[model samples]
Target chain A: MNRLQNLFANKKSNLLSIYFTAGYPELNTTLDIAEALEQAGADFLEIGFPYSDPVADGPTIQQSSEKALENGMTLNVLFEQLQQLRERVNIPVLLMGYINPIVQYGIERFCKKAAEVGVDGVIVPDLPIYEYEKLYADTFKQNNLSNIFLVTPNTSEERIRKIDGLSNSFIYLLSSSSITGSTLNVSTSIEDYYKRIKGMELNNPTIIGFGISNNASYTKACEYANGAIVGSAFVKHLAMDDYLKNIPEFINNIRPRS
Target chain B: MKYGVDEHGYYGDFGGAYIPEMLYPNIEALRAQYLKVLNDDDFKAEFDQLLKDYVGRPSPLYHAKRYSEKYGANIFFKREDLNHTGSHKINNAIGQILLAERLGKKRIIAETGAGQHGVATATVCALKGLECVVYMGEIDMARQAPNVARMKMLGATVVPATSGSKTLKDATNEALRDWIGNPEDTHYIIGSAVGPYPYPEMVAKFQSIISFEAKKQLLEQTGSELPQYVLACVGGGSNAIGMFYNFLDDESVKLIAVEAAGKGVETGHSAATTSLGKEGVLHGTRTILMQTEDGQVVEPYSISAGLDYPGIGPQHAHLFKVNRAEYVSATDDEALNAGLLACQLEGIIPAIESAHALAHLEKMAFKPGDNVVICLSGRGDKDLDTYIKHFGY
Candidate 1:
């Protein structure tokens, strides 16, 4: 079992995952941020490699991606920075981005390099299930990388079952049918959708994401799934002064330590 | 091999719905319903009626006498510029608006480069009494001020896309985000033959009336349905695809697509996509796109706002790969000069985008009796500012 499977096997609930853009704010801060997140009790983390067109992201993530790109973050540079990942960060790391860059980098080379760099999984939102299954499934499998699939409120139950079958780590449940950074409303309909997915009792765990901004939302999300992920909110936190020093506080704010 | 999209939404190895899960239901809904609605008797009658009465269809195929004499060929101009909104963009807008109504979508959203598509979408929305929103790049709004004004006058909200080169690509990205946010109520009327599966195929079908009319008219005028050469300028390739649609099966007719080479193809500033691009995904469809070595989309430059896009439609990409059509480019100066030549010779001022195709005539050595047809995709009225500044008029 890989880091992702082992983590999911050991921990059943309240598994907090954090997401941030690599090379954002500065160039050499990628590993630094990862170490800080790991130290601050993030169960797993998704390091976003910037793409010029991030259509699925909201303003906060967009700005961070732009800043990351401006800081000269490329997959080549990202991989070089991640060379020492296993030394300091023990939590499962997933590389998240659009599919074009991965295609440009050569899918085989990218997956092999991700494995070499101690990356556990990947999350490509725009990479459709059809494409992943047909083209890159074997490459990911060969690398022991969990290719995480997202489930939205709009996703059909049949498609969700298909996604669950393909997935080995966990399913990413979008808080709503919206882009990143939206506030989790937890409306009656949303609750029903959550209930429907929960009742399925799929083989994989489900981690709610895309708007678990605070303790209240996080708590509400954990009520329906295994855990919650904070992306745009954490990226927003990273923009604050002395962000590295305050990583622990940020984690505490989401789920205060007993 | 067929030049049409397959059951899987691919035109050869290109084209697919590579959108996020947020857009799956919307795209899937459109995918399932588009063909059924398009072929329905009621939908066909309504679409045909709108094309005839509202959009002024059967836009004439005029034989350009002076252009024929100058270019040493029987040159004809397919007059898409005479459409109601001053461009062929209205055809797709009307078709999509009718489709949106049938699908129960309450609002319409679109992205524009030159604002021709924006104005067209807004015009159709007003006709249907639906809310309209157009995302135009901040720079495009400044360059194409008249079109922006026209969209506003047509009762559409114009939102400026202020990210990543601030051009058509960014506007498209912004429009997509808007669609993701309001998936149920909003129907995105993607202006060009770009975007995911059904969009590229759908836009091409709506605009196919160009070739459909041209073929009938050409046969009547020249006693031959097939022209020796057919030319159109390509950005996201909607107009070019439409112009090439009916004639694609006629293997004898030579198809030529012109792209914008801002300064020159070798120069860093150019939108000559097939010339400089690599195979990749952009705007949700797998196609050729101008990008850096690291896969960042390169900002494409062109004097014509309509052609200032970094990629072409997936059909165009497939056609390029299969060698079914000739892809060429003309620089800004060449297009500008061609625009003037058309004004003086043919008594018609073509849109700068169309002028790119016209400019290529100077480079080709045609036989005296070779019949050539060019798609004059839009009028030059929106480009008067650029024309005046270039000529110092």
Candidate 2:
């Protein structure tokens, strides 16, 4: 069975996916955080590859990523961390980043290492669906890494259906108008969009991302998709000095349908 | 012909849909609707009528006899600057504004580089009686004070994008956020062919009338339609695409796309696409964009506000791939000198945007027997501030 079908087949309510930049608290600490989250009741984890200027990201993630970059993070180091963390973690891990480093690292090599390191999917914001299929889609499929794609509110119905049909399995549904960490209350946008898209009747299930934080936003996101992914807020939570100790409490705070 | 970004919207090796989930419905809506309107005969009739009456189509193909005689080269300038609102931006704006009306969108938004497209969008919104908002860079709003006032005068609100480098890219981001919020009532009229699928293709079709006109005018004047070289400046590369569209299949024609090498390529102050950019996704579609190592958008520099971009249209990259068109760059000093010389020699003040094309004449040899037509994209009156700032006599 596909990941989404398996994830939703059992009626365990909507699963919550937490995202935090790897090695964010300090260098060589990614494994501690991953183990903490997995044990603390997280269903999925997203690992961010720090870029110099993340245009789509808001302040919190920008800060964590900058700190990660300053701590001397590179693809080689990220791969090393992932290789180490896979030995310990059991939840499905996804790698999220921009396109430059992967292209520089060579896409096929990146996918091969990702599959070896227990990565289930990959999300590169700058890789267009058409280019993804033409360039990296086959390589990712070859390595058994699902290439997850995003669909914003501005996407037309025809395009949504096209991309939904083209996507390997699941879709990354963005919950807000702006980037992550934006304080914009997008409740109306969310409500209106859910209705608009429910009509398209796409077969692929979705997981919401961006602007999802705390109990309320997470609960609201779960109303539409099979799950919701939190990046900036969780990343900020993990930036704390005692994040490992607080991981169980953090997961408890964001657990859906609590 | 790489045939990338074809009717299907794939730019050969680049250009495709890479968007967030929230935007999926909107993309699908436009994708389904774009083909209907773009192909419909009634829609074509209305679009063509507006092109003729509202935008003043068949814009003059003037022979620059005096300038040609002085340079000893046959010169012709496609007078897109003569269009209503004094630029080629109206061609696309009119088509899109009409499309927005068809979509029943009540509010219109646009992103501007040199404020030309902003002005054009605001003008069309006023005529259509829809609420209009323009997003311009803070730096651009200050430099383009007159266009700002023109937008305000036309009953449109001007919002300055202060984030990032406060340039065209930032302004586009602001406009995009606004669209996401009010997708039902709002329509984003992107000024360039740099956005995601269908947009680059749609904008190119509207602007392609330039090449169609030149083909007819060149045939009438020289008893032949083909030119040795058809040239235009590359600021998001709209005008060059317009001039190159009808001639794409004409193998005898030589197309030259010139970009602003605002100081020089080495100094990191150039918008010269093929010279410095790599294939990547930017502003939505995969195209050649100048970016830093970490995939972060870097600050782009240019003396001319219009050409101050880090990327070019995907089709230009496709042109480079197939070797049908040659790309060139003009430094800041070279373009300004060319802008000044055109005014003094031909009694014509070319927009700084067009001056990049003029600089190409100095670099490339235009034989006396070779036919050369350059698109005078817009008028220089909008660039008086730039001229005075450089040459205060």
Candidate 3:
């Protein structure tokens, strides 16, 4: 089984997944961030493969992606950086990004290379669910990579159920129908949306993401799913001058103290 | 050939909502309500009135006697340049602004290459009393300064996109980012028949009035509802798609889409999408785009900023794939000469983008009575600087 499947099987609730762009702040910082997140008690890690045009990302993540690209990040470079990651980081690691770079790298080649380097799963937000099922699902499964699908409040019940049935790990529950980094308010509408998804009793566990920044929002997100993933907020923390010292503090502030 | 978008939002094997989850609700909302709003009597009434009064539509389909003599054909020009905002762009802009109002959106965001769409969008937003922002390439803003000033004068904020060749593609990227950031209140008025689903289809529908009007006028003048061929220049292919939509099922009326070949199709500096592109997704739709082996989008070049986009609309991709539309290319020199010829022959200064369509006339073998309709998609006032520089006028 994949590390993500194993991680989900072992953990029941509040399983925090931390997302950080692979080469942001500086190049060759990939392994350090991954190892630090695992050591700091993150249940899983999503290493962003930066692309030039990230339509889904808001200002903070977009800026970091731009910097990461400027810092000479590429699929080949990222794969090389993550080669020894398994030696130091025991937690599950996923590569999250747009599909264009992966296609440019060759999808099967990317999946094969990702597996060779110990990547646990992949998250390409723009890859439609139908296209994945028709063209990429078997390739991902053959390479032992779990392809995580995202569900928003606007997703139909039928589509969400389809995604859940195919997912061997967890579904990424987008907190609201907006991009990453915006403030998430757990208003009655959001609470009601959470309850509706929770009531579905999907086979795969859920992990809420998008708009998850601090402990309050993270806690509220975990109330509806298995855990929560923080992206733009954590990316903001990484861009700081003192990120090396603050990575642990940032992780600790979002996840409960172990 | 099959016409219109399929249930999956595809045009043949192209087009779909390949957007991130954050945009799902917005796209879904649009897909669900677009047809309903378009078909609503009130919406139709308002849109029709705006096109007739504000945009001055049923723009003349004038018989070009001098041009017909030069090209050996019965040539007609669908004068989209006569529209109030000076291009066919106003048609889509008016439709989208009305839709945004119906959707309760208070702000409008758009992207522009030559700035025609930006000016039109700003005009509508001003008319509707909505906040407007337009993203334009820094390079395009410099070349198309008059349009930039016009947009600003009409109360639109013009954001210059400075990244990645600083052109139309980059401007579109900046606009997409802005929409992602302000998803709740901002309605992205994509100026072309590109982007994710419902947009390509929606923009085409709004622009379809071009061919619709042409068919009626053709029947009245020539006693035939269809011309022998219809030609228009393709960028993201809004005007071309709009010009071709009403003629798709009419097998007798051949469609020709002209692409900007820059210096030449083989010169490695061109916007000839069908020739240089492969199947890929860019700006949310699956279509043919110029890209490297690793799938990074290649920056395309054309003297006409409006014809410099790297990809055609997805429907055009499908039409090209099925051979329903003949995809041809015209180089910068050829288009410049055609623009000049039109000036001398018809006393009309065609936009350099539209001159691509006019350039295709040089290659065709037309009988004396063969009727041809070319969509004059825009005016040349914005391209006056380019013309002056190129010809040393």
Candidate 4:
């Protein structure tokens, strides 16, 4: 099993995954951030390779992506930085970005390179399931890389089932139908939506993401799923002074260590 | 061999809904209901009525005698500029508004480049008494100030997209994010023929009225339904696809699409997408886009705001790939000069976007009796400041 599968199997509840742009704040800070996240208690992490046009992201992540690209972060540069991933970071790593960069890098070549770098899975939001199944499924399978799929409140039950069938790792559950950075508002309808998904009893574990900011939101999300991921919030924290030194404080603020 | 989109929303290998799961329900709902509503008898009647009475349908197919004399061909202009909003964008806006109404959507959102589509969408929303929001690039709002004012006067909220390049592409991204946030109550009226599934096809069908009318008018005027050639300027290729829709299968008729070459195609400041672009996904559709080798979208340039887009519609990409239609480009100087020539010769001032297509007439070798039709997509009223400044008037 890959790192993602193994992590989900070992950790049953209250898992925390932190996401940050690979080359944000500075060029050579990618591995440094990853090592810090692992040391600070992130169960897994998503390393976002910046795309010029990230439609799914809000202002915080969007600005980070822009900053990352301006710092000259290309897929080749990202890969070269990730060459030390296995040596420095032990937790699961997933490369998240739009599909164009992967397509330009060549899908099979990308999967192989990602696997070689100890990357466990991928999360390309724009890569449709139809195209993935028809074209790139085999390459991902051969590379032993889990292609994570996202399910939103708006996703139909049948489509969610299909995503579940195709998924080997945890399914990403967006807190609400929104871009990243919005606060997770746990209204009656949202609670019902979460309950509805939990009732389905799918094969794969579910990890709530998008708007999982602060302790309260994270705790509420953990009640419904296996874990919750902090993306925009963590990326926002990276903008603070001496962020690398305060990684433990950030992690503790979300889920205090016993 | 077919030029039309397949049931899977593809034209050959291009075009599919490549959006994130956040947009799946909205796109899926549109995909499921667009055709059924479009073909319904009541929907058709209302759409036809709006075209006829509200927006002015069957916009004239004027025989441009002076243009014919200059180009050595029987030149005709499909005067889409005479529509209520001074552009062909109103056609699709009206059609989509009706569809949105039927789908129980109360809010309308759109993205605009030149403000023509924004004006059109705002106009339709006013007619339907629905809430309207338009995302325009910060730079575009400054350049196309009059259109921004017009949209505001029409009771639509104009939000400035302040991200990457601050142009149409950014506006589109902002609109998409808005749609993702408010998926249920809002319907995004994508201005061009570029987006995820159903949008490209739906916009093409609505704007197909251009060719549908032109063909009937051509037969009456020239005693022949088929023209020797048809030309239209392509931004996201909505108007061009519409102008080419009925003639796509007419093998004898040649089709030409013009793109904006800001300085020149080779000068690194151009929106000549098919000329300088590679195959990739942009704005949720698998199409050709100008991009860096590492696959980041490159900013495109054009003097005309409408044509300052980084990519074309998927149908245009397919047509370019298969050589079904010829794609050419005109620089800003050429298009500006052509705009002046049209005003002096034909007594019509064309939008700079349309002037790109008109400018190509100077490069073509046509027979004396060859009948040619050009889609004059919009009026130059919104571009008066640019024209004045360029000419030092």
Question: Could you give candidate 4's per-residue lDDT for residues B1-393 as a string of tens digits?
Answer: 379888778999899999999998899899999999999999999999999999888899999998898889999999999999999999999999999999999999999999999999999999999999999999989988988999999999999999988989999999999999999899999989999998999999999999999999999999999999999999899999999999999989999999999999999999999999999999999999999999999999999999988999999999999999999999999999999999999899999999999999999999878999999999999888889999998
Supply every candidate's count of residue pairs whose N, Cα or C atoms clash at under 3 angstroms. 0, 32, 1, 0
Q: How much DockQ does model 3 earn? A: 0.51
Each prediction's fraction of true contacts recovered: 0.84, 0.37, 0.57, 0.89
TM-score of chain A of 2: 0.93
Higher-scoring candidate on lDDT, 3 or 4: 4
Candidate 1: pairs in clash: none
lDDT tens readout by residue for model 1, B57-162 = 8999999999999889999999999999999999999999999999999999999999999999999999999999999999989888888898899999999999
* TM-scores, all models, native as reference: 0.99, 0.87, 0.92, 0.99
lDDT of each: 0.95, 0.80, 0.90, 0.95
Pick the DockQ winner: 4
Stretches of candidate 2 off by over 4 Å are: A1-14, A21-36, A50-77, A80-83, A87-90, A99-101, A125-134, A149-211, A216-227, A235-248, A256-258, B1-7, B39-42
For all predictions in the order shown, the interface RMSD in Å is: 0.6, 3.7, 2.2, 0.6
**Whose lDDT is higher: candidate 2's or candidate 4's?**
4
Which candidate, 2 or 3, has the higher DockQ? 3
lDDT of 2 by residue, B265-331 (tens): 8897777767877776677666787865545556678888999887788787788877888888898
Q: Please report, as a value between 0 and 1, the fraction of native contacts recovered by candidate 4.
A: 0.89
Per-model root-mean-square deviation over C-alphas: 0.8, 4.0, 2.8, 1.0
